[model samples]
Structure formats: structure tokens, C-alpha cells
Target: MYRTSWSCQSRFVIHRTLVAYRTKGMPVPRPRLMLAVILFAQFVIPLSISGTAVALPEIASTLGASPTPLQWVVNGFNVAFAVCTIVWGVCSDRIGYTRSFQIGIVIAALGGVLSTFATNIALLDTGRVIAGIGSAAVLTGAAPILSHLFHGADRAKAFALFGTINGLGLAAGPALSGLLMSAWGWRGIFAAHTIVLLLALVGSMRLPLLGRANTSLRQILDFSALKAPKFLTMTLVPMAGAIGFVTFLTYLPSALGAIHSLAAGATGALMLIMTIPVLIAPVLVHRVLERTRITPTGIVAASFACLILGGVGVLMLLRPDLPVALGVAPMILLGLGFGLPLGIVDAEALAAVPAERAGAASGVINLFRIGSEAVFVALFAVILATVVTTALPGRSGQLVASGEHGHPWIYHDGLLAAGITMIGIVIVLGIVFFALTRAVSRTPALGEQLGEQ
Candidate 1:
């Protein structure tokens, strides 16, 4: 009896010691704290992007801005974001990731402050552009930081969480912005953004220390990484998502209203059915990786297949004879198709490159992701309008493009052609994806090179 009592006491002491060491070892384990900071900052970036649209009407009303200036409120930020991501990516490697991240937070906070108090439309647009430039740094800096901080499976999970947070920001942004606008007016959104970025700047101090790239300017500028078949393929995966899923996401509301005549509130509510899968899919994919022996290539293949299937299923939306309820399942499929590969592709793309160039690689990959979303969405709209023009022409086609009252059959036909075209692009991308994945796995030299890094 005495011996048993002693053993229990000994075990208790050991457990307490371990707990103390963990607590005293660092102020909240670096990984968890840093991940929190990164995720927090990442969440707000997309939130600002999507949520700002909700404020546009209010912004125009208060500022007395014309349509052209009002449009730049969104476009200016996007143009800056796309252009600066590459700049910040290369800069992060030169100055250091943590430094670049903090600088971005500062810049973003400044932009947010400017936007919050701006009296004129031009000032607000300039503030947004500045914020976008800052956001580019965060996006480019965050990935490479994670690439270096976590390795193998941990890296996968970290990025999975990263992607999940991004989706949440995008999905939740408009609603949150609307709520804030109701309570504190349009400036509340930018004020809230500034406050969050300030907090993120504080948290960044605790990030794990990492060194800047020692590579020569020529090496840093080397386009060789882009030449790798595996690297190019991994980069294209997100581009596929951008074209196949995001383009639809951007245009779906118009389709809903023009085709099925859903009200704004109803359309927003129905969108949740599709968006919920995106929020949960990264977690699900992480579980699949943890439990199963599925290779990354296999995961990529399955995701692309889901996208193709979802694309076909969404054709049901173009048919007026079909129930709107029928499109729900396909929308969910499209969410899964995009979400499943979100983080996995980031990890895979980084792994394909040398460690020293991960920062630059991250910039390029994001450029494709953001650039494609912007470009393809515009392209898809043009295609839809062109198709509609052939059938209905002039004002009717214009109304169809904008989802105002128009010829339902003509709009349906236009959407069908655009959907079919998008599917063809995704299919071609899938074939290319497969060829590249196979090539990467077979190339021992590439593996050895990455191993050396």
C-alpha cells in the first residue's frame, strides 16, 4: 500500500514538472502563438477585400463619388495587391520574413487609419491601394514563414488551418461588415481593420526568428524555379480553383437572380450551403491525410475530379425547367473541389522549390492565384455577355450580364456556354496537372536538389 502511494505521488510530480517546463519554456509555444498571429492577420486581409464591397453604396452616398471613382475603390486595391505581391516576395527574402511581415502590418494599419477618416473618394481609394500593397506582403510573407517554421505533416496542417481561416474571412466578411455598418457606419469597417492589424503587429514580435536569404541577386532573380514542371503544376492547381470555382462564385448571384429570381437576402442565405463546405473541407482533408496513406498526388487528383463533376452538375442551374434546390448539391461539390486542395497545394508548391527561394515562390504562386481570380472573373463575364449578345443583342444582353430583368432563355444559353467553356479549361488543366505530378515524382534530381536545400 505504501509503495503504490509513492508511485502515484512520483507520477504527479513528473506531470507537474513537464507542465511547468512547457509554460516557462516560451511565452505560449512559438508555433501556436505565431500561427495565431499569422491566421489573424490573414483573416482580415480577405475580410477587407470582400467586406468592402458591402460598403460601396454607403461610400458613394457619403462621398458623392461617381461610378468610375467608385469602381476604383475596389480595383485600385486589387491592382496594387497583384503588383506588389511579387515585389514583397522578393523583398521578404532580402530583408527577412518576420521583418517584412511586421512592416506590412504597419503599412496596412496606416492605410486602414487613412481610410477610416478620409473625407474624399480619392483619399479612400489611395488608402485602399496602400492597404492592398501591405496585404500583398502578408500573403507572401506568411507562407514562407510557415514553410520554414513547420516541416512535413505539421506544415500541411498549419497551411490547412491557414486556408480555412482565409475561407472563413471571405465567407464571413460581408455579413460582419454589414453588422458593423449598421452599428458604427461605413468607417467602422476600416477602423476595425486598423485595430486588428495593430494587435497583429504586436503579436508578430513573438514570431520565431529566421534569417534572410544569403543568395546573390542573380540567384534571387533566377527564373529557374518557375521552369520546374512540378512547381508550375502546383502553382496551376490554385489557378484551376480560381477559374473553375471562384469565377462561378463571383458570378453565381447574378445567375441566381436572372435565372431563378432569388431575392438578395435569400441568395445570401443559400450561398451558405455552398460556403459551409469550404470552411470545413480543409479540416476534412487534413483528417484524410492523417488517417490514410493517400499520396499528395492522389489528393490532387481527387480534388480535380470533384471540380469537374461539380462543373457538370452546375449546368442544372442554367436550366430554368430545373428546381433551384437541385443546384445546391453541385454548389457544395464545387466548394469541396476548391477547398480540398487549398492548403495542400501551397505546401506542395513550396516543397517543389528550394528552401532558399520559398519566399519568391510563394509570391509567384499567390500572383497566379490572385491574378487569375481577377483576370478570369472579368474574362468569364465578358464571355457570358458576348454569348448573350449573339442571341439577344444590345440592351437585353447587357441586362442579362448584370442580372437585371432580361430574356430568361437567352441568359440561360449564355451561362451554359460559359460554364461549358470553364469546364473545358479545368479538364485541360487536370491533364496537365497529372502529367506534371507524375514527372515530379519520377525526377530524382529534383528531389535531391530540394533535399540539399
Candidate 2:
């Protein structure tokens, strides 16, 4: 009787284990719809970022702000974006992905409404800061959730799609801002504040939520994530990339305006040209990498070299004497460098945490990206201000202050200096990425376990 009772219990426990395994693996998702929605949510914040750029001069003039203060108009939002990303990343890990995204969108909308009514630059910057915080939440939460939604080829494709949307946001921001400005002056750009948030809100409602992360909150927030050499390389290299990215793109529009003697409308068109290549690179890059069977690390290192050369080219080509297309040629290399690493680093971030902790990991990395961009933008602005202050006579300064005058040569020179700075950063970024890739070969533990999920 005792033996029989023990046998029965063993069979029962085994049966329960099999059923539990089945339940855990159940319900794969549809790739197409999932990718689309995630991409759409990601697009909102970047759109808001670039869309407001074209209207900055008008905003500066109307607010009676000087050049240095006006540059903060952009920095304020990006700073808040950086500060809040890690916080939101943790929130998404604790609460859930879909719900966290919804909160972020809501916060962005609130910030946007406040911004559209600003009486001066300070209030306007306040609105931007608040909106940035909200954007950080949405951005940090979205990427990790996508990692959960798809895997393998499907996952790679989703990343490609995400890349495309990011490209559009970067490319379109200035042109869209200019279009709105043409129709209704600077305030028109603020109109997108309502638009992107509304779209993000709708998308959030439809987005599917995933399982809770398995880690304790303390583990999720700790520095362990960055302590590993590979992870550290992934984190810091991207920061350098971001510094280069903002240093170029943020000031490019202002660069073009001065060079071509462009009207706001013409300047917007050129901004569109610089950004268009980003959308196109992902498809080509994925195919090239796959067909060549090339390692991402080698490509990333090579890309840095290309970007350094290309950045120099843009600075030199950003001349009154050169054709407009020549100035934009350098961006092609920059955009190519940009797309690959973004996808790879994003993957690195997801792989650093356990499967259950993807949301939290994503939040951390996204915060890293946002914080880096914000600081870089602020640094670039400060640098530009210092250079510009000494370069301009008081009478010349007032002309720039008016928003009606143009300074194509001075803009080019300032931009050349900015390009040199980015190249210096790229050298450091390259060293880190290269070291991390080599580390992965030795730490098979890091590489092998990453894809196990």
C-alpha cells in the first residue's frame, strides 16, 4: 500500500510539469501587425522632436530670446528626455509594457498642451522639458516589448521596421516644422504636439502587454547591467554615436540655412534630403550584412571610420560655393553608420538582461541613449554659443537675433568645428565597440546565453 501511494504521487507531479511547460510556451504572435504598431509608437516622439526644429527661429524672435537661450529650447526637451528614460525603463519593468507606454503618451500630451500657450522662452522650455520626460517613458518602454513580441528572422525584420520609422522622424522633423511654419508661423509646429500624442495614445490602447519581468526592482536598477565589459562597451559607444548624431543633425538645418542663403522653406527641404537616406539604409544594410556574412562588430568599426570621413566632408561641403547635394553626401555615410549600430546596440541591450527582464533592460538603455543625446545637444549648443559670441560683432549678432537675417559662412565654420568633435568621439566609440566584440568571443557565456531566450 505504501509503494502504490508513492508511485501515484510521482506520476501526478510529472503530469503537472508537462502541462505547465505547454502553457508557458503557448501563443506565438502575428509579426506584421505587431511590428507596425510598435514602429508607430516609436515614431511619435522623434516626430515631435524634429517637427519643432524648423520653427525655432520664429519661436526665438517671438519670445524675444537671444541665440544662446534659443538653443536651450531644444536642449530643455532632450534633457528631460534623458533624465526620465531610466525611470520609465524601471516603471515598464515593474508595471508592464503596454500600460507604461500609455502613461508616457498621456504625459506627452499634457506637456504639449501646456507648450502651445507659452508667453515666452522660459515657459516654452518648461513645456518642452515636460514633454521630453513623457517621450522618454514611451521610448524606453516600446523597444523591449517588441523584443518579446517577435523572435529570429521576424525579430530582425521588426528591428528593420523600427529603424525605418526612426529614420522618418529624423528626416521629417525639420521639413514638417517648416511646412507648419509656412502656413501659420511658429505656433503651427506646436500643433504636432497634440497630433503625435493622440496617435500614441490610440496605439497604446491597441498594443498587447506581455508577462511581468522576473527580477527584483533593486536588481533591475543596479549598476550590474553596466559592469560587464561588453555591456559597458555597448552603452558608451552608443553615447559617442549620439554625440556625433546630435552634433550634426541638430545644427544641420541651421547650417543649411546659412550656407544656401536658404529661406526657412528652402532650409526645410535640405533637412529632408539629409534625413531621407536613413530610411533607405536599413533594407540595404540588412541584405548586405546577411549576404556577406559579415560580423556586426567589424561593420560597426568600419562605419565609425566612414562617419568620421563623411562628417569632415559635410563640414567642408557645407559651403556657399558648393552644390547643396554635396553637403548632404556626407550624411549618407553617417546615416548608414547610424542604422546598423542602432539595431545592433538595441539588440545588445535586450540581451544583457534575462528574458523576463527585457523591458527593464530596454528602459535602461533607452535612458542611456536619451540622456546621451540630451547632454550632447546641450554641449553642442554651449560650444556653438561660445564660438558664435566671439565671432559675431554686436551689430552682426542683432541681425542673427532678429531671425530675418542669414549667416551661411559662419554657420559652416561652426559646423566644421562640430564635425571635428564628432570624429574624435567616433575614435573613442570605435575602440569601445571593438573591445566589446572581442570580449564576446572569449566570454562565450555572454554571447551564447544572449540568444537562448
Measured by lDDT, the strongest candidate is: 1
| Candidate 2: residue pairs that collide | 50-173, 258-408
Query: What is the TM-score of each predicted model, taking all chains together?
Result: 0.71, 0.79
Candidate 2, after superposition: displacement of residue 160 in Å?
6.2
Candidate 1 regions with alpha-carbon error over 4 angstroms: 1-31, 48-71, 90-99, 113-124, 144-160, 171-192, 205-211, 215-223, 253-265, 286-295, 315-323, 347-367, 378-421, 438-442, 449-453
Q: In candidate 1, what are the lDDT values of residues 91-162, reduced to their tens digit?
A: 888878778888888998899999999999899989988998898888877877776565444555566677
lDDT string for model 2 (9-75, tens) is 3334334434554677743333344456566667766666545655666775678547655766777
Q: For each candidate, what is the lDDT?
A: 0.71, 0.63
**Highest-scoring model, TM-score:** 2
Model 2 scores worst on lDDT over the 10 consecutive residues at: 1-10
